[model samples]
Target: MRTLIVSEFITLDGVVDSPGGGDHPHAGWTFKDVEFDEAAYEIKGREQEEAGCLLLGRQSYDEFAPVWPSMDEFAEYNAMPKYVVSSTLTDPEWTHTTVLRGLDEVAALKESDEPGTILVHASARLAQGLAAAGLVDRYHLLVFPVVLGSGKRLFSSDAAKTRFTLTEHAAYANGVQLTVLDVVR
Candidate 1:
């Protein structure tokens, strides 16, 4: 079976919203303390290399579509097939992009006998639903140093209590914590 992996950049307090520049008051918070180096890019590249496809939410797709295609660093990500979970998105402009209506479609993807991982990036509500449904197989979180107390969190109050076993962890010099976890259910 294919593994559904969630790759998130979260704050120490669990806030996952708008790690990139956006309307969130703590916009670009993830970049505030960390100094990007060769090792950071290597870590990111390794994650992308493990994924055969990119699974994203509507908002994440919308935000990434315009920028990633233009950047050389994200060429591998842009080349991979992308499935965006959304009920409202009809037409997607990105290449090799498909719009999945809901969780049913996501489940279908998980059931497929694909070889590599289905990497989910920066999609909080979708990730929550996937976790609640017990569809997520693994989580790769790059936890930043700062805390944003008021933004949307990775796990909402109403989220199901899903336990995860930490398989590996690495702490970068820039105070970034990289954790690899598997769902314990």
Candidate 2:
């Protein structure tokens, strides 16, 4: 079975919104509030090296598809198999991209014999659904020090209680911390 890992750049108050500058009022909070540290983002490079595939929700897919393919930093992601969970997306323009209908497809993907991690990045709704369905096996969170107070959050209030064991952790000089946790199943 493959492991599903939800990786996110979150805030101190658990807000996962617009870390990379989107339509949110406090867009680009991740970069603006925290000092830049190369070591803090080492986990991102590690994730690209370790991940076998990438998964995203419709919103995230739409947001990333046009841009990430052109970014040299995301070449690894562009080369890997990308799965977008969407009911309406019929044709995907990105290379090596596949459209998954819903959570059932995600569950089936998890049941496959693939070895490396199925990394989920910035897909809040998909991550929440996967967590609600008990499908996420691990999480890689880069927690920043700022708190926006109001924005889209990674954890949903209606989700069932789940526990995780911290497998790896690191604190950078820039006040950004990296936390890797494995879901206790």
Candidate 3:
């Protein structure tokens, strides 16, 4: 089966809110105000290139649709195949995107013939749901140097019991740490 990977930018406390920008209550104290380096950008570019498709939650698709479409510079991501998980969303504004009606489609995609890498981005609720269903194969946690006492966590309360094997951990010069974990039995 194709591996389902979750690529998230989180804090030490596992809060994944607004590490990009914004003054959200839990995010205000968690993210560092800094830009990514050439290496980091290249790495992200590689990830985008390797990923055959992206799976997003409702909030993430809504959050990304407005901005990512206008970002002409990052054409790879904009052109990449996107599947969004949402129950209430009847119509999507983004091009080259399909809204997954339910969890069954999500499961079908996981079992599809394509040996594709599916990257689930900034979807706390969906990530939790995927984890509970045992669909996640790997968790790529980019733990930044910050902490919010309370916020939207990467692993929410509804998440199932999951354990990860530490496969790799590396420190970048840009103050971001990369933790590669394989969900194990």
Candidate 4:
């Protein structure tokens, strides 16, 4: 079975909204910090290389579809198979993109005999759902040293109280903390 991994750029208070600048008031909080080290990039590269597929929510899909396809850094990621869990996205313009409608599809994807990890990036709503449904196998949270007092958070009131086991942790020179945790299933 394939493992579902959630990768997020979050704040000190667990706000995972718009790390790459968006419509939010404090969108570019992550970019303000400039102290990241080579180790951070190494971790990111490892995750990218290990991913068999990319899973995204509608919001993240809309945000990334236009930008990633044209970027050289994301060439390999763009080439990887991608599935977006979106009810509203009727047409997907990105290559190798598929739209999945509900949690059952996600469960099926996880239960399949696919190799490598299924990575979910910056999809807070989808992450919550996956956590609630106990579909997420691991979480790699890159926690920035900033606090966005108001925004969409990673865990909501409706989210299930899921437990996790800390598998790895790393501190970057740029004050970023990479915490890798496994879902205690």
Give the winner by TM-score. 2
> Lowest summed lDDT over 10 consecutive residues: which window, candidate 4?
32-41
lDDT of 2 by residue, 1-185 (tens): 89899999999999998999898899998878788999999999989998999999999999999999999999999999999999999999999999999899999998888867899999888899999998999999999999899888999988788888999999999889999999998
User: For residues 1-185, what per-residue lDDT tens digits would candidate 3 score against the true structure?
Assistant: 67899988888888887666554664544234544545544446657877888999998888888999888765877887889998888778888788898778888898997756888988888888888788889988877777776667888865767788998787877777878899996
Residue pairs with backbone overlap in model 3? none
Model 1 — which ten-residue stretch has the worst lDDT? 33-42
Off by over 4 Å in 2: none
- Name the lDDT of candidate 4: 0.88
Query: lDDT for every model?
Result: 0.87, 0.92, 0.79, 0.88
TM-score of 1: 0.95
TM-score for all models, in order of appearance: 0.95, 0.98, 0.88, 0.95
Rank ordering of all candidates by TM-score, starting from the highest: 2, 4, 1, 3
lDDT of 1 by residue, 66-131 (tens): 999999989988898999999999999999999999898989998898767999999898888888
Clashes by residue pair, model 2: none
lDDT tens per residue, model 4, 1-185: 89899998888998988787998887777776546466776667888889989999998999999999999988878999999998888889999999999999999998888877999999899999888888999999988888878888888977767788999998888888899999886
Q: TM-score of predicted model 3?
A: 0.88
Runs in model 1 lying further than 4 Å from the true structure: none
